[model samples]
Target chain A: MRRILRKHAIVEDDWTLDDAARTPAGLIVPLARWRAERELLLASAAAIGVLLPNTEDVEAIYPQIADRPLIALQFPTFTDGRALTQAVLLRNRLGFAGELRALGDVVRDLVFWLGRCGFDAIVPRPDQDLEACRGALDELSVAYQPAADAHAAVWARRRMRASA
Target chain B: MYRYDEIDRELLKQRTAQFRDQTRRFLAGELSEEDFRQLRLRNGLYQQRHAPMLRISVPYGLLNSAQLRRMAHVVRKYDKGYGHFTTRQNIQLNWPQLAEVPDLLAELAEVQLHGIQACGNDTRNITCDYLAGVAGDELVDPRPYCELLRQFIALHPEFYWLPRKFKFGFTGATIDRAATRTNDAAVHVLRRDGAVGYRFFVGGGLGRLPLLGQEMNAFVPEADLLLYACAILRTFNRFGRRDNIHKARIKIVLREWGVERFRAAIEEEYAKIGASAEGGQLKLLPEDIGRMRGHFDAPPYRPAGEAAADLRAQAASDPRFAAWLKRNVRPHKSAGYRVVFVSLKAPEQAPGDCTAGQFEALAELCDAYSFGELRSTYDQNLVLADVAERDLYALWGRLDAVKLATPNIGLTTDIIACPGLDFCGLANAGTIGVTHDIYRRFDSLEAQYEVGPIRITMSGCMNGCGHHSVGHIGILGVDKHGEEWYQVTLGGSAGNDAAIGERVGRALSRSEIAGGVERLIRAYLELRSDEEETFIECYRRVGMEPFKARLYEAEGESGKPVPSESEERPPGESGQGARAGMARRGVAAA
Candidate 1:
């Protein structure tokens, strides 16, 4: 299969709906294009992905695509990770139960927080070390508090007693 | 004072630990500078022009004697021996080494204080009127609501990252002493049908735009206060501008959405939340309010009676004591008690500043006689609450010993001045020097009170740190010829009806400022309706033209204006001679 950067992931040029529809089985689409061709994309594709503009935008649109096959959240920049965190909320609270991937400028150190925030897969930039980045997520086994991941609430943690 | 229960204590302990870990990682080079910057700011550390400034939360500016003592200890041990009280009711210690900050924070946590959310693009320390519980004219004490908001917003997960900092202030009194108009959102407590509730205003802000808040809700029943606030935050999270940092505050959102639409959105979200109405969730019941009121009961005080009479007689006998009594003492709401103002404008020291030693002394005084309460006012003065009438003489004697007792509380030498260009990076000119010069010129307490109730506030720039816009006699330091020149404004008031002061034509030269002020006061003295009319009322009755013309008039042979000299009487006749003279000499050196 020919490899091409997903139109939504690249900002060099404007990508049409046809370009995104023909690209691959699993690829993220720009928020505007995703919303515009959501029904058409849903009818034609095996899985659909969307890049949210912000946490608020994700909240407003999460319910509409709760049962979608695969959802990918793109962090426009690593500086503000609020949207990526909100993607975790969409999966945990709204019960999306799908492949949750993180894309766009993500690095090795952020993998742990990304996992805690419910990202199963992270797409690093072309030049970065993907395997090492993935390994970074497993470096810490015990989390201090319950985030969007496996740990319980802080109150619950305090109440838990050790096994006899 | 609200005691921290187990949950509150654990939360603070854990938060401090988390910040410590974060600091460790940043020092170990694991976290990037940008990432650490955001994290550190969330914990109330800011990289200012000269050093790392840590803003300690005051929680609506309420502090007990013990808390203050701890703060003083922190200043002495970790920081330089002083802290600057900010407009938002927080305290900023300007010089703390980055390495020692965690220890400083750990110390703060022990006193139920922390720097969390104090200097970030998050909800900052919730401010309320400094005189909240004690003010006689208050409809209800707004501290409970302020406390509730403080707890609700502190470390809120969703709002941890915002486009810009959010500020909220509450006032129970009709007089908006808390500067509610200059906050992101303000709750004004209003009474309706014998029940107290809140009126919500949104998008009010001070920096750059300086727009007054617009009323978003006519009345929010006390029960729905937090829920409604959450809804508004959610709405702003969704719609507030993000692309532009300047336009990112809630104020801009309200402006863009318009008041009507924003209100409708908040109300719609509020209805969806479906009034949880759980116990302790909504407005406090009358009994609950009364219980809270019990927490703020007046501390034990004994009537001085004849002792106060004797003190008054002694004060009258001594001109210095008389001046001090007039300026420093205020009638207490309680019988035979008085609110003693501790002036921070001592000579050669920074105005509105106290050394750690002075703070400890004040704390000792607070513990001994003043009901253990200390208040930091917006005018940068300190109030020792619940002073016994009998202890007045003794307290004055002790305060005088420390040089903390300057008897010019609201007089001319008791000038409200900013750090100006000397300390603040955002200043255009130097306010401290100008204020000093003015203090030197009108040094007589008798002359100051003779001038009568002149609020001479100065700001280095238009940001108005000294609240120049509301000063009866306002001076804004403007830069001309690369030298500092001051623009004077007359007839502004921050009381029941707040008004921004108007400029009186040309800016005055640095040398001519004191003379200019003297001329203006001379004009007021000459054209008074009665001695009862304050500087504000007098300016209102007779417009700024007369004062303006007199001020800018060319000086003659005496090296100063003849008008100023003729109007100037010796100290006692001026009504504020002794205290004013002391304040002028003291503060001018500052």
Candidate 2:
């Protein structure tokens, strides 16, 4: 019964999680189900969400995820960090502007980099502190490289100030 | 030294606060031990055999006197009275309490120093030639780029958790003193057609799988430097092995994919990043580069005022001073200044271990003679980077009082040993004891100077924290049946002539290790072409056959030599200026 945090707030998740149920309202399907039921999904569902495992060949589903409302990347382990690149490529390469949600192994500690890498909402595990996860955003005042948050890098800001 | 801008300071402050919060959570049982381990290690905290070891960043080995005093203050207030300087140009306080680390980090931040990315599976430190600015042979000073890149990689969001520890070595000198061939990604800066650029090498590492990083790009323009580095790291993050911790280094990825395929993948990743706005953000702005370049205005050097005759006469009168001058003194870019090296290896003392008293003394010497600054060498020594020629006689007096004048910078007694079983939880055998035994055997100043330029390094285990795999005479300690044993490797090097040493024979017991090392040395002394030919040069010319013949002239199986580790790809066949797949590209090793 763990809920999802979207755009900095908790939201009720009503999407169907498995392929056994075909929901007309919202369909959040795994990688296999989405690959097999692509036509049925786009034609029927109001919103489409695709779940990608850490090992999923994301380029295969890149074209289909453009108009999708959500993309949930599962982390087999918190420290694996494979999904971070997926999220980066999704935003930078595939141009997926929808909500990138981190699904499994989502803990409070990873919320900061998760947001930086384009995950807007982290669907944390049951025991995580939902309120404490919000504090991760404020952890670092500035970033060095360009990430999904798209905040100006510290060096760029310094250059601007120096020029002025 | 790059000064921190407002944004840089702000980021570090916020980073400290973030770590403080993380520490509070871990102590409160909110974060699991396994989860907090990565977080703490990224901040340079390692739970060692005795207590938590905190390593602070010394970017490119440059530090001012004020930072040294603050380090002394922390050492005095914290658990231990001593600290260890690592081969990667970072200072490690071995016994810091886990709870007080947050406060220590804050104090360190006040001096423009912190442990961010100092350890863990991330960019540890951006080390460079310690004599970058001062070396007369250097083409360009690499500190400005090193400083900029150090800040850029500090707590980089995407690179926070690397597959394995990443290291960068930058050198603008022809000498390759920074060991560029042994780091994860190394950049050698060169000026061509009046334009400055870098040659990039990737996947070089030393731990279990030693490799000389192959060249990825022949030339990356100054504007595209950071982007190129980012691309390599991104590709490594995506494709590096996560199944096995030991095989997770970027070198393994390069080996598995082969050099050409890995190079193509990095170039493709770079192209993707360049086509994106994120890559555009990675550009080093013109104004930013100019500002960084302005920080390194050289110190006002006096004219060449000291007489060489006076120094030579003094050396002739005093043999001790002559030995010190030969080993400890190096030429400086400024004619009158001598880059005086202070050796940390004394008779029985562990290499690179500096007590609080030594730190304070060195700080005073640095303030008086070195324009209040000091640089740490990868050879586990300190350099007063701006000592005047006239001040050496007086400086020797102060150094002599503190036993800092060991007169062995790269000699046999100046051995590099890791904090092996004595302090490291990962270690199987003791390294300091072996170092002590070797130092005691080769204690004579005259004999060591006679056997010139012999680099012997030892490590506790296969992790190679001591960089024993690349030592000219590498000794790796192994555990056999719950007993300590040591293996000897000959002719390993990290320089213009970089190669992984080959194992000589079978492992020796603790009692016979020193004698085994002496036997190899005796063989080198006997077989060397002349006095000028170093141990490595002689060893290289003779290959392993003569050394093997001498080593097993008595003890090996049936009084016959054992098969060597490098029989398949001997010395000249494989490692002469050849790395991975890059064969004498636009730039060649010196």
Candidate 3:
């Protein structure tokens, strides 16, 4: 039987019965509402996951839920990629060792910045191509600065050499 | 000024590269004009009336001699010879080609400076009291905190695109010299229980609508500063109005939600963020703050007796020299050392005007005499922070030779006029011309100081960029009959007790402007209880009625005052003053 996650709907092969049961029941967290439910969601498995209301919402909440089992960042639109970038910062800066995911109407082009920020998995709409979307991550080998996902401090390395 | 770490330099370089690519793509028709407009604005390039102007962040108006020299080089190489120091403590270059802006940014990166977020709808350069670390009454040095905020907010993923521009100002001094009441969010460093923290105020702003910030947090512990600021930014991002660009600022959110509701929202958000420890750890530790304070070490000073003796001798010998010394020099906390304010408001020159060569010369002087540091004040004056008493004459001579010294620091001619219609498209009237008129009127430094200390500020319009609202004798340019008229206000101040100047009466014709100002000063001199009381104190004591009566006395017969006889008609308004007998003697009128 094939099941789908209602929020992002990225169909996974290794989902258990419990995962499937919880997938359909997702809550839409407005920016303010997310702040109120942050601690509660961090401790609860029943909540499934929360949606980012805006860019600032993700930035404010990212450090707190970096280690959570499942987290989804919502982008209101593709043009303003601030929230998606914030999700990456959570994974990168704060070392948010958790399942990083992207939801909402995220465009294919933005997948690069999102991946750079730290999103390992992206769940675009059912109409989008999953295979092509995955290829977006492999487009760029070198980024000028060390972003959320990248472990190497490229700027720091340059500075060390200049001083040496 | 703090030197940038490797991280700062790297970030600036990367940012320049990113902007270069963005600009290239835009030029190649890969991005729409609207998209490019936002992108360019984020990088501090603005499409102004004449050209693309770039506003470079000075970061609390603090610069060492080396940084200033570097900026001078940039200005000379990439832009016009001069730069405009803005009210928010940023420097604006009026003439930089749009195509060359990316290159300019690259050059600035080499100096560890960039125009990032200088004009964007994001957090702008954080301003603080120009005397932050040096002020005698400063409880804590606000530079480190300002620096921390600068780093955190720069390219912050969340706040890069807020509903409107956000401004934050910090002041460590007991006196509110940073104009905290006019910023979007202001942090006042205060001492609590022998520990340092901040008293946070939010929603304050000036412009079309002037509002004082309400105290959001009574006391924010040092550790939770960034977290709480983030919480506030998050709340504002979510709740601030996006429908109207004019009303979308955080100030509007505070107005709609009320301070109580707004504070509650931030507190609620703070609670959800959980233990402030994680965010607190990012803040400068107490020891780090102390270490930073050590960088701003005070220079050595001799005893005060020798300095006083030298000043007395100068006064006895030269009246002009004495008056200049009295009005322009300020006593430093250290004895035998003084803070010399280099007045930029010279006759016919733009306020804060300094050529590239002049900037270099000033930097050289600072390196030699002072401790290699130069501070740009809110009032558009530059400070040689550590001038020795013995070197005063030599320093003054060099400054005068360069035409950098005007001998009018806080007097009538030391006017804080905005770039008005000359460079800024937002202005309605020309402020630089009005400043010229005032400078010509108070040409004699002796006469100006004799009349006593006065602050004459002019703003082109009601936006108050020149801080006209707080000037002791504030002149605002008003447009009437397709000609520029001057509206004068009195008793405004911006010290511990700040009050907006009250309108004295009717606006003056451009020609009668200088005479009208002269009459107002004469009235102030006559009405003052004592010579010691400044114009503001006297105005406060007697009110505007006496000044108004004196100003409008000549027009008593016609019920409309004819322009003063000793007034020079505005450039084009000569026909209106045909009947005046004194019109022929335009020398006195000017």
Q: State the lDDT at B276 in candidate 3.
A: 41
lDDT per residue, candidate 3, B478-543, as tens digits? 655444567788877766676667878777766767777888899999999988988888888998
> TM-score of the B chain in model 2?
0.92
Better of 1 and 2 by TM-score: 2
Where in model 1 is the C-alpha error above 4 Å?
A1-26, A55-164, B256-258, B274-322, B479-482, B512-515, B554-590
Candidate 2, superposed: residue stretches over 4 Å from native:
A22-24, A57-60, B306-309, B553-590
Of the candidates numbered 2 and 3, which has the greater DockQ value?
Answer: 2
Calculate the i-RMS of every candidate, to one decimal place. 7.6, 1.7, 6.1
Q: How do all the candidates rank in terms of DockQ, highest first?
A: 2, 1, 3
What does candidate 1 score in Cα RMSD to the true structure?
Answer: 8.9
Best by DockQ: 2
Candidate 2 reaches a DockQ of 0.65
In candidate 1 chain B, what residue range of length 10 has the lowest lDDT sum? B565-574
Best candidate, TM-score-wise?
2
Give me the displacement of residue B67 in model 2, in angstroms: 1.0
Tens-place lDDT per residue, model 2, B9-66, is 8878988988998999899998899889988988989887668989888989988888
A1-164 per-residue lDDT for model 3 (tens digits): 33223223436623222233254334334445556766764464444444455445555566655444556677665545456435644653456666566677664444555666667667655455565456555444443333564433333344345469
Q: How well does model 2 score by local distance difference test?
A: 0.81
- Report the C-alpha displacement of residue A101, candidate 3, in angstroms: 7.3
Candidate with more favorable, higher TM-score: 2 or 3: 2
